[model samples]
Target: MSILDYRRQSVRTAAPRRLYQAALAALALAVFVLGTAASVDGCTPARDPRFVGTATCMTCHKGITASDLRDHFAGPHAAIDCETCHGPGLEHVRAGGRNGILIDNPGDDPFGATPDLCARCHADAVDGHAMTTHFTKGAASCNDCHNVHKPGGFVFASDPDRFLDNAGYVQLCGECHAQQTGEFLRSGHATKDAVTCGGCHDLHVPATFTAPPENNQLCQQCHASFFLGLDSPEAVDFHTGAFHPVDPAGSGASRCVTCHLPPQRRTNQDRGPHDHSLLTLRPAETNALIAQGMTPPPNSCAGILGCHDASVPGSGAPFNLDHPSDNTVLQRFFDQIGGIPEKVQ
Candidate 1:
């Protein structure tokens, strides 16, 4: 019983010890793997000495006047650390928060560095905005219209109340487009509050009167009844008839804006922007403007390019009111065609 019993007892104890060693090895391996991952993913100073952490930046950046750092904590970017968008702040902090130090101010560099910084998180928005007139014309930037700290800063057409009065988004755009804004303010769009600038104008998309189908779609959003074949027979005839021949959904040349937003005839008529007043420019009105000796002459109907130009078989030439007879004929043409739909009149 002595040797045999001793051997069995040793085997049992050795087996338990071996199992404990293997468990300890696995635990050590897991700890090592996690620690390496943390080192790689975590924002530690050793990873990049310039990243001093949000806490470090907050130590001196609490004031609203000097820095929005205080307000930042209460904003949409609350969860996002300062350095994420601002870049590393160690050099800025060391420089005593100097104005032009290492810290990034997206507002200051809106067109350039701002787009790049925001693209890291908002690639789609940046890409979409790139296609707009704002970007192409260098007329505005992201921060120009957006309040970086507030979610309400971003204007959307669906959120009417916010877009209408939240921050006077139209006024902001008006700063650049003074003429259009002035006309728009007095026009039905602004006076009635039926729609905001964002209602028809997509701030981030290619837009113009040339793309009739695309531009007409914006008008159809509100004027859908005019396109849905729900209008009176006269109204339907007014749009699709031989006289007007406008198909909003079709690949046609005529557009809603083409009639409503006639070009303000300047010396060089082609260069002028279409009227934003949204007033229908019938031949009768054009006659009145021409009779009033309106300089450059308002070319609403007879002068819109690709409309009733010389391209038409019977249409002789574009009438710029150079001759009195053309004006007479234009008026008669409208009278014979039964004029615009009563709804628009």
Candidate 2:
């Protein structure tokens, strides 16, 4: 062959070899890209097996299934997930063993968990509840008055008779608050079919017990007329005068319980107690004194006195000091004339 022909053939051979090498490189790059994508799609970080979702929790909690999602889940803790209280359960699901996850063991977790655990998201609740008599005595807990799954679902409406008939509810509260429950049943407020414990108390958020516009306001549900006149201009003027010792503004600001049912004794010697009779004075004693033709001491009238005395003959005497028959008026006149240190003053 000619020298030029040999050189041309050699060049053509090398060209095909180069083309083959280029094709192989392209194939290798495609494989590498595919491999990377596959790794990203198939391989994921291993999550702890003990981390199960709420559905897993619901499976074993069959008894509470009906109430598990009632009332649109309204309450202080309704938003919280089941795992938050039951703990992680991924390992339990995989191993088919119950030991891995911390299921709500009623026996072991009497309160369903530590109060602090519930307090994690409930810091404000813990602080406010601490101020209450329940928390101070250590009888209070997240589950003590509430069920995380079902909350505010079974509230007693205006009718309290139905509430008293609820066996389960009565048992739950009556177990510990036996005396208070009994007193509530026998109280005039309850006897008149006026209000229930739920009327003034928020079971879900016990910290917000006797909330504003409703704490003292709840009393007005029965005493609607009295309440209407209580804030009237004439009533304000009369109360501010010699009649009501408590200033209208001050009394308005203060809770009804603070004046009427003052905290005199506690549930126990060590516990802080609050009176539920809703009176400012002893009814039996005041009646005895009135029978003896003697007037009760100051701060004893209407609410201050145990029984309502709006109709008593001398009930309005002290307040109407200008009355001719009022002893206070006579005593004041004698004090001014005789200079006897003013018996009424």
Candidate 3:
């Protein structure tokens, strides 16, 4: 062949070889990319060997150790590691998960390591929260009501209703208030609403039971118009004649439940809880027996027990010997003032 023909033939062969090489390179690149993706998918960097999950994380949570794990952790996510709540602890567990790599990056793939991430499990709680006056404002979170590793236990674990029965209900309420539960038990409205710790309070949203406005709002929930005329100028004067003290802020202060029906004289057999009844005696006839001397000291015709101190005269009308007479006058006064009487003859 000629020299030019030879050159052309070499060029043609070299062109095909170059194209084949280029194709092979492309295939190799694709394989590399696919392999890289698969590796990333299968091995999520293999969480650190030292990583202790939530169970281990709970070891130090002394405060929540006594809480009900069954109520709070009874779900699939319960098995999730504590690092999931705090963050991936590869670096943390290696260095000890305290103040280590706080996988708090919002852009992370799971995007659930943020403080707000707990909302996923607490969505129902968030929706039913009392109001904007409480945790709904975002000042609190699942951590406020629950410990990630340890919860507050069943708020009403002892109650049959799973809400709060009488005894268990009072105990939970007594946690924050050492005196109020006892007073509430003695109040007239106790049996009417079958009120208990869970009656007006939501343990999960403690503010619903604690906040002043919230407390009054809860009272109004069952009271309806109990305080309707309370703001009027004559309300104080009128209530004074009908109720023991009439002044909400006075030494003889009475709540709405106090005047309508007062606590019974006898202590409860179970928890010394008061029995609310309008009559001084539970049956009214008991009051007649006391007055007739059929019953002894501490028992009276008015059904009042130990309330009469004839020597003290008017030290306290309700507890004084003349209480029955005073109560009668007051009842009449209330009737004249358009106030409803207790209905007991």
Candidate 4:
């Protein structure tokens, strides 16, 4: 009776153990078969719906013209994978452009009003741009000036005479800075053959000036003078060493633009663009305008904040805007430079 009872209990336990072993074997076999299948299929796992290649993206993106494709291929970002910027397109593709929200499109917010998406790769440019008026003033963004599909990432590709001229750049900038562009167009710097807007300004950099204007490095690029204490020697020693005493006194106002690019008074007396004509407005010319009843005429010498207002070394008293002859120091300088030629006036 004891042997029979023990035998029946062992059979019940053995049946359950056998069923568990079979289930484990089946699960292992399934895993092995799936692994083998994956290996056979060029080592690609079952299609991850998150990331599909650019080729898959292009399949349904038939609206992208042949020329646009050529531009993308020829662009600076040609080597980069499309998903590097737009993000994985598998979800977007599966929905056949119906769920475009699945993909990241920087162009959706072209002004970069949101967090800068281009900053992922162009962090330096974005950081530099943050300090510029274009960013600080909410005027422009990366895509506002740049075209990702262009070779140089510039939006100048739209111009009929692209790359061969700077008209495109001027036109682009003029879209926003109309008054400044107008002034620049009339200035001596606007020679079509040389010295366009880009020569002085870099959009990606802070303040747009290629170098700090406070130090006169921007003007010094074209106007090489011993006054700047630069490497080159000047024929005349007028600005710093002997003639002008302010710079030696550590007065930071001794910049080239202080005299040459004096602020031109606008119609409403709103602080207008500096005189782009590059004219050194003489005290004599200012006095002449004063005599003609045009009081407080737009002249560099008098308009300067601290120069003539305080006693300049040679000019004994504060400069007399009333009498041209009274302005001995500046008039003598004008006389030396051929008496403020009508060209500058």
| Winning model by TM-score | 1
lDDT digits (tens) for residues 178-274 of candidate 4: 7677777777667644667777788768777776666667766765643324323332133432344334233444466667666665232114466
Q: Which lDDT tens digits does candidate 2 get at residues 1-345? A: 999999999999978865654454344344434433444322222133344444444443344312234332354445555556656644443433233343453325653345666577777766666666666567666556655444442332212222433344445667777766666666676676666666666544545455543244544443335433444334433432433333334344233554444333311311324445554443344445556776543222233322123333444533331122343333343232211112223
Residue 100 miss distance in model 4 (angstroms): 5.3
Q: How many clashing residue pairs, candidate 4?
A: 0
User: Where does model 3 exceed 4 Å of error?
Assistant: 1-80, 97-115, 130-132, 136-145, 151-171, 187-194, 202-330, 333-345
Candidate 2's C-alpha runs over 4 A off are 1-48, 63-81, 94-113, 151-172, 198-228, 236-242, 249-345
TM-score list, all predictions: 0.68, 0.47, 0.35, 0.64
Candidate 1 clashes between residue pairs 3 or more apart in a chain or in different chains: none
Candidate 1 lDDT over 5-76, as tens digits, reads 999999989888656544543443444344444564564442565565666565555563145456555445
- Stretches of candidate 4 above 4 Å error? 1-48, 60-69, 98-102, 110-115, 158-165, 225-242, 245-254, 266-272, 282-297, 303-306, 309-317, 320-332, 338-345
lDDT of 2: 0.45
**Residue 292 of candidate 2: its Cα lDDT?**
75
Residue 104 C-alpha lDDT in model 2: 52
CA lDDT, every prediction? 0.59, 0.45, 0.41, 0.58
lDDT of 3 by residue, 140-225 (tens): 33333333432323333342234446676566556645566656677554655456656555644535553232123444454334
